[model samples]
Target: MSDDLGFGKLLDDDGLVARLLGKTCKGRNRPLLYGPDLPVVFLTGGPGMGKGRLLRCVRDEFGRHVPAAHLDCAAPVHAERAAQHPSTRSEVTEALRELAVQFGAWSGDGGAIGVPRLYAGLVAVAAGDPLAGQAAGLDEVRRHDDLLPKGSFWGGVLHRAFRSYLAALAALFAAQPLATPLITAILDELFERVSSEGKATLEDCYGAYSGAAGHPRLGLHALSVDFQQGGEGRANAESFLFRALREDVEAAYTSVRGRMARAGRPAVLLDHADNALGRRLLRPVLLDRESGHHDRVVVIATARRADGGRFLYRSTDADAGVVTSWSPGDGGLPVWQRRQGGVPGLVAPARGALLVGMPTLTTEQQNNEVARLQGHGGHSGAAGHGARSGTSGAAGHGQGHPGPAGHQPGEHASRLRVESGIHRLSGGRPRFVTRLGEGAASLRAPDPAAFTDWDLLDAPVRSRAEPEGRPVPVADLLLDDLVTRQLPEELPPEQHDHWLDLLSHLSVAHTGACAQHLMQARQEGRDERLSAYRITELLADSGWPQCPRHFIGDRGLRHLLMRRLYRLRPDGAAWQEDHELLRAHFAARADTGDSGADEPCGTAGAHAAHHHLAAGGVEAAVDHLTGAFPLRDPSRSMARWCEELLAVAGAPCAAPLSGAPDDRHARALGEAPPAGGDWLRRRVDRLLHAVWLYEDRTRPVDQALTGTWRPLLDRLGEEPVPGTEVLTRTAGEWAQLAQERQPLKPCACTRHLG
Candidate 1:
């Protein structure tokens, strides 16, 4: 029910990420200027900034019309080939073959293949052609070679057989060549291997995979790994890969242009060209071919800033590929930031070049996301604070959305915190978020004290925490040998720290207290300030569930405060000092004290009367009943806890009530009706106080209110209380107040006192 924003889910599915990226084309202007068509176009950016996802979008939009191939550079490939060798035609060919088989080509029997068989084959082959010694629990394939043959690796065999079958079927096309033009696609990591090769191979055929012919041809579209490559090794991988992949891509592009008549659009989309690749790799791709520059291919590159050196490469000739940039900020800023700067502009000038930035989600779009998460409001399974990530709040939620009519009363809760944007947090880097999401929520729950004993929380420098607290063998880390095993491995240290810190703070109820305590401890040198800030920053940047305000009551303000705190740390010492300052600031805020009106209408000290009752000590049954009254509010649900404690201690319940019998009679308790007149109001008021208490203290609910129940219930019905609306309805229904003749003012024991 909390409207806090931490629930924004990850852009997990590639399809979703693609959708988000397409929205980035806001201006809808000319095609964005990127690299030349003759050079390989490599998209680069900080990890999770939408490089892969953007490629998927381009593929979705232009793929069918052109023989385009999408390669996920993050997929695992054969181990020996992955690290030991550069991208070979054979490996790429094998990958293309696997994609074809997995996506569904004819079977060797010339019959339609099942999607499952193809998918399984892809997973197996992608598992990196496990050695014969490693083929335990796998179906053994018949092979002529001692080890798996080139085309006989589990994935390779499936692909080769599928290709032949598909080729045979394509013969039926007559006009459209039986051989599918090889469109080799690869993501950034795999492309790094291609860049290392420094050349292209395979021929004939147009599209990305074409290179040398007679053998299987090659044409490739690949991402650049500038961030990952060591500077001394390859200062700008985009340039290197672009030049290398371009040789083949251009040749295939020419073939496609000739065959198709209209010039084929051989496009390259480069994301975040401000990095090293933009400088070294982008010049050739962006240059115009009419003045001896590379021509015929269309290149579209995107960057955060067009003024950066990467996009500033200059040739003497004028109109060298129109240099225009698209900026999203012009239209409107996203809601996440108040008055945020407009999106950067698209930097292409060609009339139909189609350059644009992404579109920001409208307010309605954002609200729809929120509504989907909160469950059309007032419905069951409406995401109670304790509900699991994606489930109904009610027990009968198994019967989810029945038809399009509406959500049934028992429908499970939809996921909360829907986040959508150009580089959606969830879809673009699903693996990263999924890993964090599945593991983090529990770690960041409102209970930091519980985590003190966690083994992962106390991890050593070189050790990885057990994912989700499930024991993962250290040896398993060794198995992650493929380059694609962990894609997008280049988050800025600050952003990484932001996410970590956010998670840590969310783990406690009294986030303000935790912050103050941590800061004070740092000032006292009891805890390392820089280390804690680093941890907090990493979590925040990663979009973990961080309290928006120091207090849960103002989560938004808290988030902003946390951001300010993080930004204040210009240097290590500065950061530590800032922590000290914040410690003092918060201490002062807490000392200001709650200054709300002190009306005690619901309370019956009549002031002095209650004091006298308490003086009588634990045996003052009336005092205990009065103190315990507030616990009945289900909104707080604290009453049940108190009831059990009293029962266990064998406490007396003969509280002073205007109507109930004296302490001497046992059956008199049953004779009185439940407490009335402002009872619900007091309960609600008391409940409000408890929200803050539950957040800051460790007192058991039962023990805290044993002698304060009656007054508390009376307070609960007060206005502005959290559960006021519900309590009002329920209380009236219980009292039948509307039908009562005497405006029923009852005693603490629920009997009419007037």
Candidate 2:
């Protein structure tokens, strides 16, 4: 479990633990700045984002400072134990008992937490049937008798009436066959022995049970009554357990000594909490918290759903809504300094959950991670060996490595390239970084200087871990981990097989409608495919982060899908055919009054041009781009327009064609570049090549690509397009933006890190 849950090597240096703890007000000054509200937090990220591991790290590392207990909702132990029993009522009662015991034992003061109602209900149920429950009733009493106060509650009752144990207990049960009245009487006697305050809180909370509203003693009766007639009634009893558990936590944490030792709110770490059990538990918590029943427990749940579970979160639709997702990007501020950060406000729907993400590795962090994995903890780049853009291990990840000034001549440059390639391929995602790094470590490279791009991106993962496991490529692992394997969980089990094939085809589309167009066409004569909108929802639900413009939102996922479509079959005609489908689809929709002002390639012609280029119809792609070029609103950002146009054409058909496709329109991206004749064609060709250079983020900022814009501006100086002046000015700005996006060279002192 620890091996599976630990990613602290990647996350420890990032201070994610401290940051999350700070959000929960672990060490804040008394009288919290925000109004008395600590929003329930859902720590969310997609697969490979390390949400569960972060929870474990926090629990083990900060156990003393924060009275935190981690519960795996995905595999709730008590729930499973209760599943062996015949009654659903046991689930609510047993779960509350477990929660009470977990929270009860952790108090700083000598205070015990117990659910007397649940205990009394269990005893009463067991006592009613002598054949089934006499032994069970005695077992329950022996197990939790210590949780009940010592003096009168049990002593007076058992000594006075039930001296022979089962005989007297069963005789009492015989007096009342129904569980409700008997359990109520038992608790009423037990309540007299506890502290007046604990009695008051329990009585006040249980007094609201509509089944026996007037008598505070009837709470256990209410639960026992529901337990007798098992079904939805038993399930409804689960909702009341939180109120019971929370009141116990409040009571135990109330002692002056307890507050002094651990003054902050205790935390509950709910891992894999987007599952059915999690939803069931969280829905009631959310409803209770929303209705103003606050407590001293801070819930930090992990969710695979990117936006968190829909029921656990309501994204406050108003501007003043508060959700604290503090990141390293925010200026360093103590938890106390942030104003109204995590406090849920009075906005409509008042944000039910605060959704924060685990940080993906930054360039420097990734470099350090690779260094650590490859048994070179200090090596990021070899300073003085020609790699100048690298920085030292950020946040002090390691004992700094010696500069590779004396190593093999191209050692620094080679390492620099590998690091850049890995970051580009991985997008700094931690799991991918680890896989690629482990893959690199397994390979017997003579020196850091000799590694290749393929070794880092498509590195062997399984052959290292298991003797019989095939050497599945990192990309395929990613495809399986992120998409293919998640389909059953994301969609109906029956749809998983067919939906995967449909998604592969829809990868060529730029938007949902475009995807649907392709999907409907592919499924035109069959009922195999689901509605396209539902498919899009499935992608989002599975946490395939979307960019709205592209149908497959994740860059890495799209890259794998695109390569598959192009390389799966001989000649890769399916790639061109799919692109042609999109080309024709968008072509018909071109010039319609549906283009969004903000969508640079919002015009159908531009999208058609994009697919045209992708499908190898370069001439038509250029024609469409050229035609759409003049239609931009000059007042809008032309620089943004250029950036977006670059994105649309976006290094499509990155590698040149091999065998030919038959369609005339397929010539878009398949041909050799025109031999330096047409200016726009040449410029477009250069722009595409230039965009390719930006893929690797940590690579040297190629100022030389900046020169590509110079020639474009120079060409526009002579042969003007419709928006030439705006284009010329925008060209320089786009050039600068390109520079802004790339990692720049580091100073002499930090030259060995990234």
- List lDDT for all candidates, in order: 0.29, 0.55
Q: Give a tens-digit lDDT track for model 2, residues 1-754.
A: 1332224432232344444443222333233322245566676777777777777766765544556777777565656776655443354455555555665466433434444544444554433322345335445444554344334342233333322443444456566554543344445445544456545555676776657675656766675566566666655556666665666566545656455544545667887777766666676676666667777677778876655755544455443334455443453422422232344533322255666665667666777776677676565334222222422222112223443555444334445555655665566566767776776665553233233343454566774446588887766676676666555355776676676577777767766667777888778877556777888777666655666556776655666676566665677777878888877776777656545444435556667777787776766765554444444243334444564466555425623233333232112232445554455565565555455444323234445555666566556446533556766776666666554443221222112233
Candidate number achieving the greatest TM-score relative to the actual structure: 2
lDDT of 1 by residue, 399-466 (tens): 34452355343322222222111012222222223222322222222222121111111122222444
lDDT of 2 at 506: 71
Task: Give the runs in model 1 whose Cα sits over 4 Å from its true position.
Answer: 1-54, 69-241, 255-263, 269-503, 506-585, 588-754
